[model samples]
Structure formats: C-alpha cells, structure tokens
Target chain A: MNINFTLNKKSVTIDVDPMKRLLDILREDFRLLGTKESCGEGECGACTVLLDGKPVTSCLVNAVHIDGKEVMTSEGIAKEPIGKLLIDCFDETNAVQCGFCFPGFLVTSYHYVKTDGEKNLNKIKKALSGNICRCTGYQKIFESVMLACERKPLMNANER
Target chain B: MLDINCQYKSVEVSGKKEINMKFYKPKSLLELFETSEKIEGKKYFLAGGTDINVQIKNGMIKDEPIIFLNHLTELKNILQSDNHIIIGALTSFSEILESELLKNKLPFFQNSLKNFASPLIQTTATIGGNIANGSPTADIVPLLLILDAKLKLFSKSKLREVPISEFYLGYKKFILKRNEIIGAVLIPENAETGYETFYKKIGSRKALYIAKLAIAGLKKISNNKIEEIKLAVGSLNEYPRRLFKVEEYLKNKLVNEIDFADVEHFLQKEITPITDLRSDKEYRYRVCINLIRTFLNQ
Candidate 1:
C-alpha cells in the first residue's frame, strides 16, 4: 500500500505494509534513525513522535494511521526554534548521557515545553514520565526542560 | 498458536504483493457496517491499536481483517443529554483528560485516567478498547462499573444496550457478538450526585505498573449514616466485580456504627484472589480489606 504523509516539513509517499510500525518505517524505510525502539511495546517512549502535534509512541502506531497526518520525529525537531533551544539546554545541563534515549526525550520534552510549559517541577516530571532515561537520573533532564522553558520565549501554536 | 493456513492472502498493490494483510479505515458508521457485512474472514476492530499491535507482534493474535475506527467522526463524539452523557467508543484517554464535559462531571473517571499506563499509551488507548480488551486488570473498567455505565453495541442489523456490569461473561470474555462493535458509553448525568468517590490502584510504582489490586467506591453519607454505597474492585480475581455483599452491609448503617474487622472477613469471601506475577494471593486479600477500611474512613 502507498502511504502518503508529511515527515518533518516535506510531503512524501512510500510503499509499505500498512500494519508496519511507524518506528520501523521511519528508521528503516526513510533512514531517519533519530527515533529509537527500546521496549517495542508502548511502555518505554523511546519511539516517541509527534502525531498530529501530540506526542505518541510510534512503536504502537500503525503507518496506515498516518495516511494524511503530519509526523514530527526527532530528526525534524531541531529545525524548529523550541527544539533548538531544548537541545542547547540539554547540552548545558549535561542531560544527554549515552544518548541512546536522547531523541525520545527530546521529542517528548519538546511537546511538553511547547504545550504545557508549567514551571512547576512536579508537573514537568509527570509530563515527561512516559519517556525513560537510564543515564541521567531525571533531575538534570527536568532541569534541562526547565532551563529551556525559562530561556526561550513562550511560543505560539504556529511556531510549534 | 495461530493457524496461518488460509488466513494469509497476498494482495497485489502497485504491481506487487506489497501488503500481507488487508486494512480498512472506515470514514462513517454506514461505511463501517457495509465493510463489516462484506468481510468473510475474521475481523478485529482496531481502536487506539495499543493492545492489538502488541498482540499481533507477539504472535498471540492470528492474521485477521482489521477495521480501523479512527476516522469515524460519529464514534469520536462526547455528547451530553439532560440526564446522561454519551462518550464515543474511540475516545482516547488523552482526550478524556482534556474533555470539559467529563472533567466537570466525572472526576473519578479522570482520576483513573491519570493512573492508566502512561502519557504515551494514554494518547492512543481508548476507553472502548480498555473494555473490549477484557483484561481483568484494566484500570478503567472498575471505575466504569462503579459509574453504572452502559455500552451501546451496534451491529449491521440492529443496536443493543448492555450494562457495563453485565457485559463481562467470564475471564477475558464479553457478551458482544462478532459482528457487533461498541458505539458509545452512556453514563448517567447524576451518577456522581451527592456521592463522595475514591479510586485507588496499589501498583509497584506509579507510571506503568499494572494494578496489583485496584478499588473504586462511591459513598454518600446523610446525617452521619451511609445512605448509598457502590463498590467495585479489580485485579484480584478472574474479572473485576462489584461487591454486592459488602455494599449491602454498609448501606443504611451509620458510618461509625459498623465494625471494620468483621466487614473485612465478609469482604474476603467476595473475591477469589490468586497468586500472579504482579502480587501474591495473601497480599491481595489483605490490601483489599485495608483499602476498604481506608476508603470508608475517608
């Protein structure tokens, strides 16, 4: 089946099984390896991606569901202003350890900071609970997201 | 093990057999029924695809026709009537959290939604799927039961309403027909009226832990007397069930007049807890009594 969807900012079509996991299609078919798959199940948000502007586990999402929807993986997030600011903050806070789970954290944190941006530490922790990090004990990750939200100006929906 | 004998069919797409299984995304209810009538082989209704995807990958499910309900606008509505609210079957937990209609009315449902799998899974896990999946540990089922929710099951020929309490037949079993799909959940508008409710899930940790033993209760005290009480517990038996005996014992009694020690012994007979991966039978039996005592004291 031919699946037509927007990746990053470009519209593209690919011939693949509709039941194929979006994580596999992105990493293998599109060669966009930014999205990682750790548990394969939805437990770990290592394969997190923005589906129609909401963060979801791509490992559980079917490619058929993305027929006309827009998918923003970690690869395309850096181009956005919020994504760049988050990356910079992560670097300054030493948030990225082994970097295996960095992309998922980046994508999930990007959506969290963009939409909620609650300065409360507990709220931020709850928002990012889906994504797991083994290297950083989450204090630095929370600090990184907090720093990014404080340093960057509040973005409009159009900016996201 | 799945018998993949006649289930595998090679579909020619773009001059090649690119797809292994057929996938249907229905745009409307009429289209969904039409497609349902035409399909000859096994069919699985895909909602959220959270549980179905894992089952398909793990070889626990066989190769079957999938009917995707994500595009049907009729099944995605959260409508409110004067006396009741109808939540569509495809409504996700994320949507449930954000719904003003549900937030103002049914906060216990929202409380259960918070303890559901995770934010990632909640974004895609639908209430319909949670009920249809028939897992004994489904966090939302017990709450729905306590809310006195009813499910609207739709077939190509007719539609029928079944109370959520009577929907489950046994372990991982529901009374739904093969051709039927859940349309919407009908919850009474005054289900929470004058009732103080509590929902608790004792899990290993907060985020992704499946409930060792979960409890949902709705209690109303009038003049220091227990006027009405409804209790449902899950993950302690073959299926989640309402505690009729306990509910009856507590009703119409003064809150402080009842002894909790005898009540715990009576409640133990209501459940058949078994040793499982999540917890031991003895622990489940003990925590349930403690939870009930705590809930009543609250």
Candidate 2:
C-alpha cells in the first residue's frame, strides 16, 4: 500500500505494507531512529510519537492510520524551541542515564510543556506516567520538565 | 550508527513475514459492509488499531484482511438528545474525557476512566473497540453496565438497539453478528443524578496494567433506606454483569438492618470467577466482597 502523510513537518510518501507499524515505518522507511522500541507492544512508551498533536504509542498505530495525518517523532521535536528548552533542562539536571528511554520522555515532556505547561509535580507525574525510565529514578526527569515549564513563558516572551 | 544498522536488519527480516496481510480502507460505512461481505475468510475491523496491532505483532492475527474503520467519521461524535447522551462507538477515551457534556452529566464516568490504560493508549483506543473485543477485564465494560447503556448495532439492512448487559454471551463471545458493527452507545441522561457513584480498578500498577478485578456501584439512599441500587463487577466472571439478585435483595431495605453475610451468599452465586494468569480466583472473590461491603457501608 502507498501511504502519504506529513512526517516531522515534511510531506513524504512511502509504499509499504499498510499493516506495518508506524514505529517500523519511521525507523526503516524514513530512518527516524530517535523513537525507540523497547516493548513491541503498547505497554511501554518507548515508541511514543505525536500523531496530529496527540501522543500515541507508535507500535500500536498502523501505517494505514497515518494516511493524510501529521506525525512528529522526537527527532522533529528536538528542533523546536520548546524541545530545545526541555533538552537544556534535562541536561542541566543530569536526567539522562543509559538514555534508552530519553527520546520517548523528551517527546512526552515536550507535549506537557506545550499544552498544560504547569509546574505542578502531580500533574507532571500523571502526564509522563506512560513513559518509564529504568535509570535516574524519574526525580531528575520530573525536575527537568518542571524547569522547562518554568522557563517556557520566558522563552515565549523572548520570541515575541 | 552501529545500533541503527543492527535494528534495520531486524526490520527487514520481520517485514518480509508481515507483508502477506491485506488491508482495506473503505470510504464510507456502506462501503465497509459491502467490502466485508465480499471477503471470504476471517476479517477484523481496524478501529483505533490499539488491540489489533498488538495481536498482530504477537502473531495472533496473520494474513487476515483488516478493514480500516477510522475513516468512518460519521461514527465518531458525542451528541446529546432530549433524554439520552449518544456517543459514537469510535469515540476515543481521550475524546470522552475532554467532552464538556460528559463531564457535566456523567462526571463519575469521566473521573473513573482517567487512568484507563495510560494517556498514550487512551488517545487511540476507542470505546467501541473496548466493548467489541469482549474481554472480561475491559475497563469500560463495568462502567457501561452500571450506566445502563444501550448499544446501537448497525447492519447493512437495519439498525437495532441492544442493552449492553445482553450484548455479551460468554468470554470473548458477543451477540454481534458478522455483518453487524457497533454504531453508537446510548447512555440515558440524568440516570446518575442524585446517586452516589463508586468505581475502583485493582491493577498491578496505577497505569498500563490490566485490571485484576474492578467494581462499579451507584446507590440512591433516602433516609437511610436503599431506594435504588446498581452494582457490577468485572474480571470476576465470564463477562462483566450486573449483580441483579443482590440489587433486588437490598432494595427498600433499611441500610442499618441489612445483613452482609446473606448479601455475600447471593453475590457468590452470580459471579463465577476462575483462577487466571492475572489473578487468583479466591483472592478475586474475597476482594469483591470486601469492596462491595465498603461501597455499601459508605
């Protein structure tokens, strides 16, 4: 099946099996390797991506579903201002360890900062609850996102 | 770069095995029924593709044609009428949570389902898929059963309404026919008003864990006498069902005068929980009794 959709702000088309997973399509067809695949099932958020501005597990999304839809992987998010802010915060807080889960975390946290952008710990925990981290105990990750939320308003003002 | 190369090689090997499956995307609901009728072998509807995609990766579904239903926009809205709140079957859980109408009317449902399989899964898993899959442990089933929800079953020729309680015949077995698909779910408005609502999902973790056992309750007590009550249990029987005998036994009885021991006897008869991989039978039964006791005592 030939599927045409926007990938990371770019309009692209691919002829692949419609039943193929979005995760596989990104990594194999498009070579967007930032989205990891820890669990082939939807249990883990390692394959999380933005499908039309909503976070969804890529492994559970079929290639056919992405037809004419907008998809953004962590690689695309990293180029945005909010994504850069989150990365700086994560770097400052030393949140990366082993870093297998960081890409998924980055995408989910970027979403939180862009949409809700609250400094509340409970809300942050709930928003990132789907993505798991085996390293750093998640405290540093929370701090990094909270840092980004606190700095996001300032960044927006600067952009204006 | 080395890791990428290793992963790319594995994808090629798996891609060859998965390419045999065929996918059909119908432009309209009518086309869907017509296309499905022409297919000879087992075919599955791909709405949201949350469960079906996972089953495919696990090799449970192979070489079967999947009819894509996400494009059927007609079956994806939450509308309100004079007497009922009509929810299209393909309405995702996230969409339901964001609905102002549901939040205002069915606050209990919106609040309870906040932890339905994490925020990521909720974005793609539809309410119809949850019920159509007929899993006994489905998070939405117990809530729908207590809401007295009715399903609008659509076929090529006609549409019929069936109460959700009667929709299930056994474990993973439904009264839904081959040509029929769940069109919408009808929940009566004000059905939950002036009643105390309770929902508890006991799982291994707070998110991304299947329910070991779940209980949903609605009670209307007047002057310490039980006026109306509805209770349902999931993951504790062949299918999620209402505790009709228990509800009947407690109706019109003074709350202080009721004997829980007798109520337990009635509950034991209705639910036939078995030992499974997710939970133990004895534990499920005892926890259900305790939870029921707690709901009533409060």
Candidate 3:
C-alpha cells in the first residue's frame, strides 16, 4: 500500500506492507534512522513520534493511521519551540545518559513542556510518567523537563 | 499454549483519499465485519492493542490476520438522551477520562480510568474493547455494573441491547455472537440520587498495574434506611460480579444496623477469587472480606 504523510514538515509518500510498524517505515523506507525501536510492543516509548503534534508510541501504531497526518519525528521537532527547549535543557542538565532513551524522552518531554509548561513539578512528573529512563534515575531528566518549561516564553503566555 | 498469528493486511482510510497507510486499514465497518466474519478461527480484533500488543510481541498472536478497528467511525460518539447516555463502542479510554459527559453520567467511570492503563495505553485503548475483552479486572467493568449499564450489540443485520450484568458469561467470555459488534453502551443519567458511592482498587503499582482486587459500591440511603445497595467487585471472580445476596441483605436495613461486621459477613460469601501472578487465593479471600469493612467505615 502507498502511505503519504507530512514527516519532518515535508509531504512524502512510501509503499510498505500493511503490518509494518511506523518505526520500520521511518528507518527502512524513509531512511530516517534517528527513530529507534526497543521492546517494539509499545512498552518502551523508544519509538515515540508526534502524531498531529501529540506524542505517541509509534511502534504499536500502524502506519495506516498516519494518513495525511503531520507526524513530528524527533528529527522534525528541531524547529518547534517545545522541541528546542528540551534539547537545550537536556544538554544543560546532562539528561541523556547512554541516550538509548533520547528519542522517546525528547518526544515525551516536548509534549509535556508544550502542554503543561507551568513548571508545576507534579504536572511535569505526571506528564512524563510514560517516558521511562532506566539510566538517569529520572532526577536530571525531570530537572531538564522543568527547565524546558521555564525556557518557553510562548507556552507561558498561552497557559490556562 | 495459545496459537500465534501475524499475517497483517493493508486497509484504506475513508474520506482521507489523498493519503494512505501501508498497514491494514478497513475503509468501512461493513468491510471490517465481512472480512472478520470470513476468518475461520483465532482471528483477533485490534482496537488500541495496549494489552494485546505485549501478547502479540511475545508471539501470542502468530500469523493470523488481525482486524484493526481504529477506522470504524461508528464507534466514536457519546450521544446523550433523557434516559441514558450512549457511548459509542470505539470511544477511547483517554476520551472517557477527560469527557465532561462521563464525569456527569458516572463520575467514577472517568476517574477510575486514571488507573485503567498507562497514559499511553489509555490514549489508544477503547472502552468497547475493554468490556469486550472480558477481563475480570477490567477497570470499567465494576463501575459499569454499578451504573446499571447496557450494551448495544450490532451484527450484520440486527442490534440488541443487553444488560451489563448478563453480558459476561465467564472468564474471557461473553454472550456476543461472532458477527456482533458492541456498538454502544447505555448508562442511566439520573441514577445518582440519594446514592453514596465509592470505588476502590488495590494495585501493586500506581500506574499500569492491573488491580489485584477492585470493587465499587452504590448505596441509596433514604431516611436512615438503606433503600438499595449495589456491590460490584472485580478480580475476585471469574468475571466482575454483582453481589446480589449482599445487596439484598443491605437493602432496607438501617444505616447503622448494617455495620462493618455485617458487611464483612456478606462479602465473604460473595467473591470466589482464584490465585494468579498478582495475588494468592487465600490472600484475596481474606483481603476482600476486610475491604468491605473498610469501605463501610469510609
């Protein structure tokens, strides 16, 4: 089947099998290797992607659902404010340790900072609850997410 | 051991003609029903696949064609009426958790979902799939039973509504026909009158932990008398169960007369739980009885 969607803000098309995971589509077909897959069953959010601006586990999600949708993969998020803030904050806090969890953490933290940027410590913890970081014990990662919220001036203006 | 099947098919998304996906996508519910109907055996339905994805990754589902129900538009509405609210079959747990309608109709139905699955799982898991899966510990089952919910099952040509109590036949079983789809769930709107309610789930972990024992209660305390009491307990039986003998005993009893000890006696005979990885039979039997006393004190 032929699948078309906006990836990294560019419209593109790919032909792949029906059962193919989005992780495979990004890596094998699109040649975007930044998105990794571990525990491909969706338990590990290593395959996280922004489906229409919301972070989701890409591995468990079938490519069929991406029709015409704007998916901001970790590769695509560099231009967005939420994504940029996370990147800056991660480096500041030494948040990425071995970095196997980088893509998932980046996507998860992007959405968290975008949605709940009040710097409410509890909200940050709750929002990133799904993004598991076995390496850093999460203190620095949590600090990075909080720092990202602080850096986003636009997110605060729109905060409810 | 369960046979595993993994032959996947491509489906087309309706209305979005310009873009397409490689994965199997049925353009319509009719096609989904027809395709699933023809499969001889062991074909499974994949809605959100939050619970089943783990099973699939472990090769629990081998090469059988999985019927993905994500594109079914008919299962995505929350229609309301004077008598009841009809939540479409595909209505997601995430939607339900954040819905104003669910909060109004049955508050706990939405609140309990906070612990239904992980936030990621809730984003994809559907309410219909949860009930249809027939897991005794399904977070919504006890709440649905307490709400006196009913299901509208749809087949190729007919639709019928069945009360939630009669819906589950046993463990991992329901009275649904092969062709029937659980189209909607019907729940009463004004049933909260004079009713004091509580929902409790004891879990090993806060998020994504399936409850070892979950229970819900609704009591209609009228003028110091227990006009009615409904008890729905999960993870303690083959399927989530309604404790009639206990409910019947509590009804019409004075509020204080129905003390903690009395409630304990009734609960002891109510649940017949089995041992599983999450819990032991003896522990369930002992803890469940004590939970009643705790609930009453609360």
- Model 3's alpha-carbon lDDT is 0.75
What DockQ does each candidate score versus the true complex, computed on alpha carbons? 0.55, 0.55, 0.40
Candidate 1 residue B65 Cα shift, in angstroms, is 2.6
lDDT of candidate 3 over B142-209, digit per residue (tens): 88898889999988778899999999888888899886778899988765545778788888765557
Off by over 4 Å in 3: A154-160, B1-25, B222-225, B255-270
Ranking of all predicted structures according to lDDT, beginning with the best and ending with the worst: 2, 1, 3
Native contacts matched by each model: 0.61, 0.72, 0.33
Return the top candidate by TM-score.
Answer: 2
Instruction: Judging by lDDT against the true structure, name the best candidate.
Output: 2
Residue-by-residue lDDT tens digits, candidate 3, A1-160: 5678999889988765545667768887888777877766666677888887777787776666676778888887766766777888999999988898888888878777776678888777766666677787788988998887767875545432
Q: For each candidate in the order shown, give its overall lDDT on alpha carbons.
A: 0.83, 0.87, 0.75
lDDT of 2 at B243: 91
Clashes of 1: 0
lDDT of 1 by residue, B1-298 (tens): 1111112222122232332466676667877888887889778888889998888766666567787787665788787987888999999999888899888887767766786888888888898998888888888888888899999999888999998989988898889887788999999987987889888999887678789998999998878889899999889877888888889989998888888876776687777786889899899889988898888888
